[model samples]
Target: MFIKDYISKDYPAFNASDSIEVANEVAKEFGYSHVFIKKKGFYLGALSQQFLEESAEGTLATLEHHYEKFALLDDGNILDSIKLFHTFNSNVVPIINKLEKYQGYLSCDDVFCEFAKYPLFSENGALLIVQINNRSYSMTDVCRIVESNNGKIYGCYISAFIEDDVQITLKISSENLSSIDETFERYGYNVVLKYYDDEKEELLKDRFGFFQKYMEF
Candidate 1:
């Protein structure tokens, strides 16, 4: 789970005194938009690819004014990479220790691959998206609502916030999909979406219910 496990040294960190050409070569070679610069075994910051292309010739230290400051600690989880990836718009994210020593980096691809291994993404199940007031939600209540209806929740996360309400997305496995939907509504949850699989099973259930009602008469 720690970021250090996936740290890649594929892209080398540059010393500030290193030549602009050396940094440019590495940046272009790896197709990275930013290059990590270091001095005395500690990371200074990063200089964007655009800055290197514009400067005619100088040491990497000369481009100090153009450095962008951002990095993940080696101990941070891979999930932390998503925010940095969006904020910096970098193809690869740098990793550093608490002392600010440069560790390595994980590319955007690496982060995605790691995320794909999690049950929330990798598991096979239907997705239910429901909206409820902020004060109306709790993990226990949500889990109870799903499980009481004979559904098992694989995982759940807040999908969005609307005014004082929050929308939650849960990956769940269930045979009685309609029962789960009905249960959520009975509990005051606004079911925005129920992306269940196995339509044939649902159709069979409906037919069986019709037969039962007919026999009752």
Candidate 2:
């Protein structure tokens, strides 16, 4: 799942001498929003389509163009690459080698797909949304509550509301909704949402009849 596995060798890259027009054409042909601009084993920056359309030059090297901070990495694990990709909001990131030379670009989708295989919990799990006292957001309290109810805590997402209330979204491996709901509610943990809660099937069917009339050939 590392960058080495997902790095795309086929991605179209441009050289310093390449015309801005050529870069735009390559981007259009490849259906890419941005094109990598490189010089002899080194990545300079990227050329964006939006910048090309707005400027008079409409070229990669024009003064009117700008690029976001390039995400760089020498060698890293899959976890490290995923963290960098999310932080930079980049689709293609440059991977550097030990020699500080450009190796290739990692496609964001490929990297994410690999990381998703290892999730916080297994697919057969339920999520509980609990509202606790504003001061109680510690892991100890969360573990105590889940263990008391014979539920195994798979993962937890802790967040604070705008009104200073603490909310803990705990993922448990228990599918017994009635028992889990009653146990948490007894402990004053307001259950706002449940991930395993069954949806109202008729809701989608009812809307489909109304939506079908708007469809035209």
Candidate 3:
């Protein structure tokens, strides 16, 4: 998926000449936290609601904090855009041409909708999560291991921890869980835990108890 597939054609935008008050109204009317600010149909940055509220200066263009990096979309796949969105921890990404002309915007909702079409997890498959110390943690080792065991890794996710380590989540479909576990363990990845839905009744009960208490509160 790319911005072409997920960006809303009707989404609101702003221009440099637009007053800060006008931007605020657009944000309020559309219920958007930020609006794409453009000039001569070229992508500039963004004007956020927080920027407006925190700014005492009435000048919209003079507000230095109103500027932010536009989430540039080159000729890339939807998965690539998803990675960028996650890396930046941003909700909206601006699409642009090679010459840096503004195209449109992609929202976080669109990305999740695209991913939800695929499987996030599966009980028929063994899920393994590995923790490492770098974002560049290679999946080649696990991919090779799964293939060697006649298994298939359906998807993978790599994230960083606050303590400088990285966390990898993998979804593997296999007939033998023990073999997969042994292979991952051979790679020095500590197995945190393992489970199947049939074995999760007790676990669900404990979790539900906590959820019930939280709901009551």
Candidate 4:
């Protein structure tokens, strides 16, 4: 989804001339570690709790010297926001318009929620990882095999690739994937990994845990 759809104005922003005390108050009130600083309508940067605590007696303008100018445009996608989250290790990211006007911020929760809604994660399905030669791979045959076995593909993604081989991860709607597995084997596709509901649940739990820990910065 587009970043603007999930942009939130709930988080507070401070004027460049505002005090670190004001920023700290707003952050504490909202349970945020950082707050955005703007000059007029344009975004200047962000001030973090650690920065504010270390340099308490300063204006937002002074804190601006230490702020990281991380932001995404209004038309950017969720992937773009995710990159920013990882790069800056921030819980929230500022969104700006074409004119560089601060629109709002996208929170970690919002991005995580959006990610959870993706078919690969949200759908009740089985995951199959297949290894295949890059030059010989054909998605048409893969779909045919699954469909022929009365299985429905909810989603699929390419995981990793080497020079000659690639790994493809498929999310299938059927719980019983024996026939599909046999079909792939019959067609000479090597099944590298498989995950059913129980295994997928554990895997996702660990993944989300890592995601939460990653966002804590």
Candidate 5:
């Protein structure tokens, strides 16, 4: 999804002439660590809670030295937003238009929710990690082998590409992976790791439950 689609315009923004007290109140009301600052419809920067609480008295423009300017353009996608969040260690990020006008802010929670909905993460399937020489790598053959064993591939992605080989991670709809694993090995593919709900149902159940609980928090 695009950043503009997920950004929330409901959040507040402060003017350069606004006071720290005003920014602090807005941040508290919105449960945000920082609030955006703008002047004459132009994006200025942000004011952090720490800066507002410690400053004696000053306008947002005067006391904005502590805040960093980080934002993504409207054309950027979810992956771009995620990278900025991790790079800056921020829970919320701003979005801007092509003209550099502030659009809105995106929260990490919302981005993560979108990510969890991806087929790679949302599907309940068997995961297999395999290594094969780059020269002999053929996704068609992999699919053929799995299909011959009555298995359906939910999704697959390349994990790594070394000098002479590549590592691939496949998500299969079938839980019974013994025959599939043997079949892959027979075709000269090395199975590095295999994960299926059938063999580790209890472990997966506990972990998934913990993840759900954590997300709720």
Candidate 6:
């Protein structure tokens, strides 16, 4: 989703000549990691809250050299903000135009709200985390495996990379989770983590009961 409409101006962007005390006050008020800096309608960068505290006294002008240049362009997708949030360790991301105009900002809370609207989060489903070799993995095969087992995939994505294997986390709706897990294994995928109801346990109990009866013969 394009972020043009989601731009928020609730967080103040201080001018370059703005007082350090005033800037710090606004930063503290908003509980943000950094306060945006702008001059002549163009964004400069950001001054971290910790640096603002150390500043004690001075104008933003004095700390121009310390500004951290990080911003998301206006054309960026909402998903893009997540990476920037993690990369910069900031709760807020500044938005700017291609011509260097300071537009507004996107809050971490707002981004999450946007995410919660997507099927990956909103739909009811069982989640699975499976591991596969990087060289042999195919997204097509993953989707095929789940769908062939009478499962409907709400969403799935590669969640991690561990040495030679990558873990894919999937949110799928189905009651045949036991069969799905076994199917993944048969297709060379390791079902490392799975979340579901008690169907698997019930199946195990029934199998154990059958084993005990057979032993009595």
Q: What are the per-model C-alpha RMSD values against the true structure?
A: 7.2, 6.2, 6.1, 9.3, 7.3, 6.4
Q: Which 10 consecutive residues of model 3 have the lowest summed lDDT?
A: 117-126
**Reference-based lDDT, each prediction:** 0.87, 0.66, 0.69, 0.84, 0.82, 0.91
Which residue pairs of candidate 6 clash?
Answer: none
On lDDT, the stronger of 4 and 6 is 6
| Candidate 6 per-residue lDDT over residues 29-82, each given as its tens digit | 889999999999999999888899989688999999999999999998988888
RMSD of 5: 7.3
lDDT of 2 at 59: 44
Superpose all Cα atoms of candidate 4 onto the true structure and report the RMSD in Å to 1 decimal: 9.3
Residue 32 shift from truth in candidate 4, angstroms: 3.0
Best by TM-score: 6
Instruction: Rate residue 110 of model 4 by lDDT.
Output: 86
Candidate 2 lDDT tens digits, 1-217: 4556566778766776677777777767766566777668667776565555555644455532475546456457655766655666556666677655667777667666774664444445677888867765566867776777677776777755747678888777664566878867777778888876233445676678768866742
Native-to-model Cα distance after best TM-score fit, residue 149 in candidate 5, in Å: 3.4
Off by over 4 Å in 1: 197-217
Could you say which candidate leads in lDDT? 6
Candidate number that wins on TM-score, 3 or 6: 6
lDDT of 4 by residue, 73-152 (tens): 98989788777777877788889999989999888888788888888788887889998899888888888888888888
| TM-score for candidate 2 | 0.67
- Clashes in model 2: which pairs? none
Sum up the clashes in candidate 5: 0
Q: Residue 169 in candidate 2 has what lDDT?
A: 84
Which segments of candidate 4 are over 4 A away from where they belong? 162-164, 186-188, 198-217
Comparing candidate 2 with candidate 6, which one achieves the higher TM-score?
6
What digit string (tens of lDDT, one per residue) describes model 5 on residues 97-175?
A: 8887888898888888998888778888889999999989799998888888898888888889988999989989764
lDDT-based ranking: 6, 1, 4, 5, 3, 2
